[model samples]
Target: MGDFSALGEKLKATRNKMGLSLSDMSAKTGVSKTMLSQIERSESMPTIATVWKIANGLKIKLETLLDDSSQLYEVKSIDDKLAIKDDDGRMIIHSIFPFSPISGYEVFYGVFKPGCNYSDDNHTNSTTEQLFVTDGELEMIVGQNTYRITAGCSLSFDSSEKHRYINNGDIDANVLIIVNYE
Candidate 1:
């Protein structure tokens, strides 16, 4: 099966394992029931933001929903990595490391165009994020605090609170982000 179909099956199985109905899943994910149903049926492809919401609602790492973890070793080039684009296509996230329940962490390489802002809701409990700015500038807001990180800078914060990444520089902002679920 294709990746999307596999993802749909996984979603359905996860929801079933959680004993959550479509309505219950919708309530938790903030995605409409119809949309969730469509996703589970592989009738619709969810956006990157939608995928994140589902992962958070399910209390699982995003990689758990993206990668087939049964493999012992996997090698992926930039072109082979799973990538998701924002609604406006201003932000792209490349899945650099797959999710492993044993490892309890996932990594992503993100690129944000100038003037792009990607806001995210709180993740599951005890989740934390580490971000390293590789190029340009990034304005990261966690809860009520904002930090400006330039190239070669890194920051870590609790991700169980609302957060936002804003690219205010004229150039694109590139970052390596790692999410840990403790």
Candidate 2:
């Protein structure tokens, strides 16, 4: 689970840094003042949609709103990476690159068990994903098209459309995914 209190603190700090009061934030984000207050007080957890709106209103990247401040440079090994698992536990994604507005990109190392399928909704407009397969096979479906990506192969596609990744091979599928935001 995410640390809602930390998120709330970041929101409040960002708003304060911008010299925006609750009313100002509400006006800019089109979110109810009460809701914003609740979120800032850690009494409520904002939905992804609400967060997106807030990020847009603040004119910052979504990652900027969520990322923790770090040193000028950092290194992360496999064990240091944070992994997110799917609800069904058949897919796992390790964040290989920490989110940063300056980089304008996010990277993940994903593992899909045989027969597992991961479906994703459209991302922000003009976002693109480059996927490189390292092991096994992956079936990628983007919009109305489908492509079979084998080991050592790479595929790039606009991620602003619905997509799915299926591991139909007998073994686990390993893929490196890089997402670039426009």
Candidate 3:
């Protein structure tokens, strides 16, 4: 079983340790207070974009949300990985980076096991996300429309548009998600 609830609890604790209230986080990240509350309560999972917003707002790195002991070090390969576990202790490999210089944009390799997913949210600036499927399939729901991308396929869209990704396949799915902050 994954422990996403514990991860959420740690996120809440970190937010409190930084002296940031839910309202403050919502204001800073543009995420709704209601949704933030749900995340804290382990009722829902925060999307990658949501996590990025919270990380930037908290003036902390993304890895901090995964593990409290991770330093401000950089990751530069498939071996360097981060996982977000669900309350049931199901591990989801959240992000991956390769050996390269840090640019304004953030890149990630997302691996979604069967029946896993994250919802979409709003963005401040003109953020863009491009995903290339490596294995299995992905069901992307953007606004009221839904699309599927299979292995060897890719898709890109603006972050301002509401979007979500789910793995409806019985096997695992791998995707490289790249986000451009600018």
TM-score, candidate 3, is 0.51
Instruction: List the pairs of residues colliding in candidate 1.
Output: none
Q: Candidate 1: where is the Cα deviation over 4 Å?
A: 1-74
Name the best candidate (by lDDT).
Answer: 1
Model 3 C-alpha lDDT per residue in residues 120-181, reported as the tens digit of each score: 58566647888899999999987788889999999988777888778889987888888766
CA error at residue 27 for candidate 2, angstroms: 14
How far off is residue 5 in model 2, in Å? 32
Against the true structure, candidate 2 reaches a TM-score of: 0.60
Greater-TM-score candidate between 1 and 2: 2
lDDT of 1 by residue, 28-81 (tens): 989999998998899999988899999987768887677775665867787887
Q: What is the lDDT of candidate 3?
A: 0.73
Worst 10 residues of 2 by lDDT: 63-72
Tell me model 2's lDDT, rounded to 2 decimals: 0.84
Clashes of each: 0, 0, 9
Whole-model lDDT values for every prediction: 0.85, 0.84, 0.73
